[model samples]
Target chain A: MFQSDEDRILTLITRKLMGEATSSELEELSLLIADNPSYEILIQSLTHIWNTSPARDEDFLEATFLAHIDRMKKNGCDFDTYEQEIEAKRPWYSSRKLLVPVFSLLAVVAAFFFWPRQASVNTPVIIAEKEIKNEISTRNGNRTRIQLLDGSTVWLNAGSKLDYGKDFGGAKREVYLTGEAFFDVAKNPEKPFIIHTNAIDVKVIGTQFNVRCYPTDKMVETSLIKGSVEVLVKNRGEKWVLRPNEKLLVENISYQPLKKERNVAEPVRARKVFVAIKPLTYQNNDSVSVEAAWVKNWLSFKDESFAEVAQKMERWFDVEFEFRNESVKELSMYGTFTSESLQQALEALEFSFGFKYAIQGKKVIIY
Target chain B: MAAYKKLFHCLFPSIQNFAFSIVKSRQLAEEIASDVLMEVWVRRLKLMEVANLRLYLFTSAKNASLKKLKQENRFSPFSLDELQVEFISDYGNPEEILNGSELEKKVQEAINELPTRCKIIYKLAKEDKLRYSEIAELLEISVKTIDNQLVIANKKIISAIKYFVRKKS
Candidate 1:
């Protein structure tokens, strides 16, 4: 883009210094400045140079001054007091104190520019207290459904234990959940309903959803069926939230936890899940059920991980499962069964996944 | 400072942001900031023609805050805890959700302190409902710059929010 030596060089330098140069322009300028100290001085001098016929020092200074004005105009920046002080030190310095006001104007512009902003007082304070005194356990053959005091609905999947609800408090609303549960919350503004799993705190005001939070699986999955919810969990320190229809699977889970997996996480000292609200597809029916299968006392799955289904199976049958080939973790199934038969469901699963099994009372074994 | 009173009120809703970061003590913050306001009245001339009083107040507030902390250091050492309140409602009051408009306003103000380019870009994209290409043309830049600006802007905003939260914690 250069034509002459001095004028072309100065023009390019001015553009580059003002941050208007494109990537290639910037690269060329950088390369030139890198090998040549004189070039760097020349560029800086452009700001100090005068722009007049034969360009006297005063005129050159005025031209440079005009360039700064135009660049700032394009940039919409005003003068600061320091610059005003400098100009005040000049023959035309009176024009510079106006610089402070202008800089103040620029500060208004900067207010619109800087990151440290004056944001309103209503930043939503996320408060979580997941202290539930109960050590809940589920049996393999039964389904448990509970209506939380907040009007949120939860269906405890079979064989899964959810430690929840002593009560809700003003600054915080929380429940410690383990294994799996489907949730339907009643909307509330003043307080947010939260579920603290071993890894995250799932939050909502009023929304219908299901969270399969068993650590046994490779991931913790949350499925939203209605309304909106925010999943706030500390990921290293930052929290996150999930919106409706979006399913989040935390894939960083340890495989051993999914093994004879008793309690997935420590039940305390974990992160919060974070999700955001987005536009949603309107529901066709207001009566949509998040726990349609288990609410009616049945273990239901149209297509879900077999291990997840097995976790439900363990809860319903109140049994422990010992898998011979840990590879059985890959198989998934979709089927629903009433509490009518944990034995039949296991028999069907054994037949489909192609594994050997034995039932020693409540414990099921496959080798 | 008298000239700033109106702007101060407008900035007041947002001052908690700077105050939280500086004071480190809410009671001391509220008190000193009020003192700062009185000082604004007492030394109006020195502050007169102060271009960005938001910046000035913030700097003054911050200096006053540092002084207060130093004074507290002259006293005893201590630690406090969360003011745990009983659940006003077992879950939460259903009525809070019904009142949605207030939350939206709060969300908007929180969006304000973003970088100017980011502010313009976000407002153009969100409020005036412009396309990226349209924004690029108006600003004479690349659409990608606008996107990057948003990421940076979101980071600053998110941190400010967390700063407020951690102050209480």
Candidate 2:
């Protein structure tokens, strides 16, 4: 046989890798490997590449579902109902919630144990169906305007995502928000627009309000520009109504991971949702409200700690910050930046706060 | 719609990546894939009668991607007779194989560098795991074309791996 015949044998081995080779082809492959010796190495190399290829990884599943849900929503198709239909039909996928996370955790632990061993069990064959919802996410230093079907306009802040189902505006208009958004809801007496966040649920009827509820932030704020919105605090079931130009700051006490004991799963401490309604701060000679400054592409903070400011800066500039000293986190700062480069912003902060910061690529190390 | 979602979750990545290999843009590939899967959903009643679901999806993705290419004025028409396989001397370095992530990336880049049709064939056979006959049936080409494309793809992958190894050394 010629060199080209050996290539043909390798192609047969490729067929074997894909479970497409016949018994005769397998026998031919074995014969070729025995004869050439080089064919064995070729098969092993190719198989290894095939098995561990990145294309086999399921990282795009979440993204694909998001995009699919967006497409489905455009067609007036309800994804939630579609999902429910699938769940109702498939008995095998019934216990997916409990089974999937456990399997994923095991897969993670197994990956750690078998990292060097190159175990084939690294990939799990679990098909978990997470609820598909339409999601729009904005990165740091970026803002977006989303116009809903109900003629409501939402100005989404940097590093925010607004998720709503296809059933939005049909019955009860509700949207799940992370980070922050300024909602200018259309007047609808029958259907009240509701915004669900980690901290509180803001229900509005023809209202314009800015809700800041970053998961990492300590407080969830609902700053009303005009009209009224009823805010319901989670875990406590306490409700507070906010008037125009009034900001309702609710302490995000529901998700206190540290309050829970290390071994215990449920938190034993009595969580309290503290509510405080205050007039919106008019800054820069009453030209801008501090809470709504971000909507105008201006970064503003009042009496916020360095840690809080660092979080805001992270979103504002899309740069990661690391405080070398813990004391650096506690330093108090109140400042507003409008159209300043990240370096200039940091320089202003450093001059006033008397701290040193070094920019290393996309990271800032503060001392 | 239910069956479409099930089939979608199962095979989306393969279809999307296959489209990506052709379009060279993730966003366009995703759009093409979404369009193809949406068509499946729209025609769910008729899909059951189709002989092969995987072949149908891959074919749809390929056509949609090609159509998108033509619209974008990036379409360069060439025949399969123009294909010339290049062979590389094997370094077969152990160091190259051990770094899984880097090697996987190099392999993906290699697959990415193949001529459009050959890349799609390689992805179908290797990534999507479609059979030679299935690929031929989907592309409406002969089994010999599939074989030739796969051979070209394999040679290119080996060449890429060796190139990475040589660059590293």
Candidate 3:
């Protein structure tokens, strides 16, 4: 197609507007525009239009990015692992500054655990042999189900930890728990699965059970769903056998020992470790027990006080709650929440309890 | 990590818009954009060897969008003439320009009436700030074609302004 000079000038001008024109092309454009002076206004208008930027909603963009991150996580892309892998791949000299303190802290912990005694000085050397301990933990608002080497499956609730040695499932099946978990022990007559907690130990041959031993809770609870298990209270040195649908509650001795030390002046009241056996809580014909509902992604509470439910909600939603009015904490609440967002949950609670609450970032203030 | 986030915020919308031009679905476009950006993170070390990261990302988005269309059984080998490209421009204060809102409206209408290929080229050049060669590489066309299409777009808008100028005189 034969192009006119007018069309040629516009092409060069467009290139010039986009900063794509060379110095020679620029000179050619300027000369062509000078010859057709009437094109000056059109060129100026085009430049003005090109310079104007489209309106952007930064907050919307940020929200979209965060949602994208969530989708990535749901798709099994763990960014935290990638970050650690990248850090590990960095040059040693560059990583040494950050690794030094972490290594020193590990050394101190190791020394405390393996300190040599006068008679057993040689034992420290044997104990220093590397024993790989596998630890799996879940952050608040997240739950994980992991299968053990023994074919047993364990579901860890939010804000829980399950630690086991590398030799687990070989000669001994033992795990240390700091929070809540549900276990379905694989049947192994030779090895009894044992869970060690701060206040008690749960021993079972083949059973389905749930254990709740959060550090913030006042008691340790073991709820057996299908099979029998034995619960040993550490402070009381008593073993209680639990039948199916039985739940044992033992007062946490970790906090009470410190309280007893503080109140030494008082007469020694025989504070036998408070212990009780009760039936597992079931809600309105639901086969799933309230105690183990979290395994199924439901946060269930049965006639629990608002204060107790708030603690559960904190882990379930990864939020901090501040109760401004003390009376609001004592209000008995009962409900099951599965997939409601924090805002919707709060609104439902507000409608029923008539409590005023405000959510600021990750903190919820109740009055 | 901060650099990755900065890159995401800077490039996501533009990539999404480009994909939207091909897929014609906002949700699918956003998904394609996310997938493309995530690939950058996945291949961060390898991508450092790429000469033009922006062009690489745009090309990835284009391929992903076309793949998504194919998955949905809507794939037709992309023809620039068949694509519906949306061009959005912010004329800050129309009254400050020559002959005010009438000319601005005319310019907008002219942009709307532009051929699909011409509008896409114009948008990539003006809004996305892509060079002529980059646009040519992304769209799989020659730089001469881009140069001519851009002239066609500009001539249409300039004639809109000239119409108003003639009427006023």
Candidate 4:
């Protein structure tokens, strides 16, 4: 029980803030504040503080959820098997319809691994005349340089795969990218080059650009360096025209259709997606854009949070990072690392950020 | 699996905040919440045996946060008098605090200055928008105790603001 009048008043204020106050209590509070002008400040200050606390911040909670999902997957929770179990109970036609696109992509990927290339075999030039689909992949902790048949050059980042059809330079120059790459296409007015990613389609006419759309990332980013590009967001019917030194970011929120009401006739629409366009960042005292710096093997970031930087480091070094301390995620970092070993990079970050990290086998835990 | 994911989404934010209030560190709070959820996911088949999932989650978050605090050597056993003094005193300059359009920031800092248990109860009431009875059930405390803690939180916030004003004068 609140014995003192001041204690009772404070309790009433708390009740009011929680929307639990009775009408009599509300009237009493108003009278108390009216009788004493200073009580007005007390109420106002408490209200402001209650409303502005970081507990009400949604961004932090969203990041927490994403981190939880990442941890669960890392622990080998077998989410795919669980998903398959649910999908198996669905109608047979529904599952069959879903397999069409997947099977086609698998066929393309299969052709890439087994087809014999005339350049590799000394037997016959007939294989060279036949149109051949080529697939180029960079394994973990490695990057590769590739020159296409049309003299275009591509620098593929680590853990990335790019596949092109047989008629690459004939009528349409198109490539499907699964991870990240920097593309420098040769000029060809008759054919429009397209870079197809899972989230968006980047169409260009012989230009240099960077596309980063990792499956684990929450957004797809495309930064143009030398020429123009029109980015078409899949199923969104939205197009973004990007000029040189421009970047487009598309948030990857998948569409979840209504299940119970399957008979309703509604046009397929993208549900509440987000996109942002901004100027590409330029590294200081250099002509190169920050987005395209990976082409030169320079790991550079400008004002990126530690969590984001950690993801990049994971792919760059092929190591697993386990964050034991959450406060370190919000720390903003900016630097350039070129050819540094994983330990050296971690050491540099530790010195700059004043956080202690321990390396055990392939896992780096920051506390 | 979608049902499990939905449950996780609905409950994680409040549980994370609850842990943060106990630990007073964002990283520890996130880790605690994630660890609790990981346990739930690993023993998902046994989840049906638990009658009250929300209370289970809150308990897990609280125990894990306290354990981590102890492990980090940051936990000091508290007394009622110590908590009262902590809730009522210790604030810095007004000139640095009372800046432009940062009244919200000042208020947030005041909330952060609250005693750990008081802050957690206030968040359960205000931020999570849980009813007093609901929070009492989750924390396994009396409803009257929840009411007293919320009042303590409001009083401490006002005291912190007054501390700034007196310093300015």
True contacts kept of each: 0.04, 0.08, 0.40, 0.26
Indicate the worst ten consecutive residues by lDDT in candidate 1 chain A: A47-56
lDDT at position A358, candidate 2: 96
Candidate 2 chain A weakest ten by summed lDDT: A119-128
Q: Would you list the C-alpha lDDT of every candidate in the order shown?
A: 0.48, 0.67, 0.75, 0.67
For residues A1-367, write the lDDT of model 1, one tens digit per residue. Answer: 2324333344345344333456576556556655554444333322221100010133433353344345444543433443464345431212333344333332232122111222222222122345334445555554566655556666676557766545554466677776677776778877888887765668888787777666555556666765666665445444556544456565433324643456655433354333333222211111122234455454555345656666666766678777777776656554445434556566544433445578898787866
Greater-lDDT candidate between 2 and 3: 3
On lDDT, the leading prediction is: 3
The local lDDT score (0 to 100) that residue A60 gets in candidate 1 is: 36
Could you tell which candidate, 1 or 2, scores higher by TM-score?
Answer: 2
Candidate DockQ values, in order, are: 0.03, 0.05, 0.16, 0.14
Q: Any idea what lDDT model 2 has?
A: 0.67
What pairs collide in candidate 3? none
On the 0 to 100 scale, the lDDT of residue A239 in model 4 is 90
Q: What order do you get sorting by TM-score, best first?
A: 3, 4, 2, 1
Which is better, 2 or 3, measured by TM-score?
Answer: 3
lDDT of 2 by residue, A143-209 (tens): 7777777788888888899998777767879999988998889999889899998878899889888
- Model 4 chain A: weakest 10-residue lDDT segment is A113-122
Off by over 4 Å in 3: A1-3, A82-367, B88-99
